[model samples]
Target: MTRPELKTDPKYDDYDYPTTAPEVQSGHPGHTTPEQDAQVFQLRTQLEQAGYKERLDTLCMLRFLRARKFNVDLAKQMFIDCEKWRKEFGVDDLVRNFDYKEKPQVFEYYTQYYHKTDKDGRPVYIEQLGKIDLAAMYKITTGERMLQNLVVEYEKLADPRLPACSRKSGQLLETCCTIMDLKGVGITKVSSVYGYVKQASAISQNYYPERLGKFYLINAPWGFSSVFGVVKGFLDPVTVQKIHVLGSNYQTELDKQVPKENLPKIFGGTCDCKGGCALSDEGPWQDPEWKKPPKWEQPSKTSQPTTTTTAPAPQAASNAGTQAEIKGAQQAPMGS
Candidate 1:
């Protein structure tokens, strides 16, 4: 029997995404191979040199192309021609005789097996595939076969841990994509609006002593706007801008109430891999040269000051006419 096919052909050309030839790039440090891997990587670079930017995964894109325009047999042959054939990498490499931590029965009792008689009532023994006692291994289980060449289509998140060990940025974005769907907002619906959401989500998933910090997109796209103006005109834009304004304004007021020496210390280092983004920008964006808040001080409260300002003393007018004006000024209410 044949395996499952990756792409589904459509009856009509409803959505024709422009055909983009994928740009393949070489693997880094660990996975690079001295064989055909080099040739595939080199070809990928050449394609980039030719000036083409259609973000496509060579293998997956081919599957999509063959979808409706081509036949299944033809697709299969094409995959074969591309040498996309895959299988489990040698199991023996996984720590010799490690019958995979799965099959327990085979290891626990070597001769033990499960059985049932055939239609003829003869004894039949089935190989005990369970009870395999493999020791603990570090690598997390991954389902997809390794591809020889792949080009990143966007600013891929940097995560060095295995999928089992921790969630990487790409994984986090995919998760956010699923979450947006749950909120009844499709990816196509908020393609651009949800990017910051994805970024915040990925950053929050980073490993820390604390349970991975929670992802909270301030002014997230939880509300809708019904505008009646030309495009790009105001109307409060999205909730994010409002939240940003509120935060900055609040911080400014908060700073006014505290001593200049008590502000939060800013942090910056070459280690920050976020491309100069302010997510980790601790000290004031204005001047890193200024001294940071000392360890003993607490962060300034975000609320407004409760103390009232003293009113200016009422002045005595030199003449009666001026006296009336002075009284009116003294009587004026705060809001007025």
Candidate 2:
């Protein structure tokens, strides 16, 4: 049998496809803006001078800069503060060595999980806030351990999760699709967990800027929207825009962005993976059968020092290529 001819569109004949994981692209101001590029360069130079060259990458630096709206001094201070926190929290040691043996037990009381991919191919992170029982959770794990687990998950997201999603989608995916379920939450419950929630939110927003692509507050209780209206006044407009507060009738809207098969049965879908959906970690990134080819070329060890700062380490570079290839194959037509 003869294979069909591969067709090309003239419109995209001049399109320069991304060859690297975080290569600059249109529409993503955080990655492409001239000011951001300058800031990234400046930040890297400063980090190297401060002997923190090995501690962070351009992407991490950009996150801090974006968090501070590209204010050099503010971004530097934020980076320094994060470094201090990392030492105090032992985040590096946690990432390399810490193990959460109580993950299963803790999840039973507080459902926080990365289930599957949304329509845009971003990982879907769901947190059933109403299900959280601090008393029960603390029996298995302390708040400190929970925060450590959260940090580990965030590190994994930066390494394998987003990279894998980006590879599968044939584009850079630095953010996640989030669903915060507040079905049984009341004022009393909210007050009970206010401190923990506030701390977690601070860590995510201040330290991991641009990590939230889409946020859905589903199963919103009565008066929650009005409360959010007041709370949003203190949030960045860009952050507020990504959040959608939905009532019980959120299935229709959720279905538009997430396939029924990908979503869990509890969340108005049919997926019931073995063990449980909350712990399944099911997604394209976890598919062993879908192997991604290496698409990014490794930079030479002796490349110009200026360019070297932009390139990630050898392992990271390899992972980026692997991820992009996986996403490209999964999402795009063969020989397109």
Best by lDDT: 2
* Off by more than 4 A, model 1: 1-175, 178-336
Give one digit per residue, the lDDT tens place, for model 1 in 192-263: 323322332222211100111111111123232221122224222321121121111233432322222322
Residues 103-124 of candidate 2: C-alpha lDDT, one tens digit per residue: 8888776777887788887888
RMSD of every candidate to native, in Å, equals 32.6, 11.1
Q: Pick the candidate with the highest TM-score.
A: 2
Local lDDT at 296 for model 1 = 14
lDDT of prediction 1: 0.21
- The backbone clash count of each candidate, in order, is 11, 5
Q: lDDT scores for all predictions?
A: 0.21, 0.63
